[model samples]
Target: MLEWLAGGAEAFIGVFNEGGKVFIAFVTGILPTLIVLLTAVYAIIELVGEQRVHKVARYAAGNVFTRYTILPLLAVFFLTNPMAYTFGVFLEEKHKPAFYDSAVSFVHPITGLFPHANPGELFVWLGVAAGITKLVENGTAPFSLAKLALFYFVVGLVVILLKGIVTEWITKIIARREGVTL
Candidate 1:
């Protein structure tokens, strides 16, 4: 598995690293996107089966699930792993010099993949996008990619709040139907 990743990364890089960072970038950025998609789908299933709020379920499953936003956040975490270990182990055999090159190189702005853009940069941008999305939905601000990324953490916070309330209600109902007491 490890050997294939390093050697095979050049092929898969296109899907995850639109910015082209590849290596750890693909793992952190791309893999997490998959997780988000999976999670959104899972959330939807939970809501539907539990008979929770349809709107939240649909939004999470449909819009958020499909949206490309999660990828950036994933990328951020993916890149944090040691560059050499990530790229060398997975994408290519350890080339000490190339490992250093990837670790230090900054990603290209237009490409987003890179020369080797820092994952942190993409993370911040995604965070901004998330924040902006929240602000827009809440009537707090206008839509803007940067703003959304800036507020992404807040957006997640808001989502969590909403999810908690809704999930709690669902749980209580289910408990009642099952003849269980709170």
Candidate 2:
């Protein structure tokens, strides 16, 4: 499954690379530009909506921060880093319902949610989960630890590159629209 996904991503990259003018103009240029324009429009709408709901001074910065910074941060981190996903899970656990831990305990008979009840246990559980996923999906009983590490590293690199390109383009559009010299 991983290989299949990797192959597909490679194929898309190949298309972008070899398809030249048309593909680049669409995928690398127009699509991203449209997303940036949409983001700017959404930001404007949010500012107006917030001002209508409450005092402009009270909600303006928060709305801007959420749209321009927070959402972008989440997109970049989640795309590139597996560890970031787990970190978010940990943070979410704190706000979870009373039965959240109990639910985990009920499922996953072997691990019984015990392995993920704490931070230290959580990392161990993640490794076990990754190993099990690799095994079930590929018919390999167990996956090599080194291979898992390498996979994480590669995923991290992908997230970094894709996010960098997306955020940079979006920033350029925003800056231009806002009349920032940079």
Candidate 2, residue 64: lDDT = 29
lDDT, candidate 2, 56-76, per-residue tens: 222322332332233223322
TM-score, candidate number 2: 0.28
Rate residue 22 of model 1 by lDDT.
46
TM-score of each: 0.26, 0.28
Over the stretch 72-119, how does candidate 1's per-residue lDDT look in tens digits?
Answer: 222222333233123323221212223233232312121122212243
Instruction: List lDDT for all candidates, in order.
Output: 0.41, 0.41
Listed per model in order, the count of residue pairs whose N, CA or C atoms clash below 3 Å is: 28, 1
lDDT of 2: 0.41
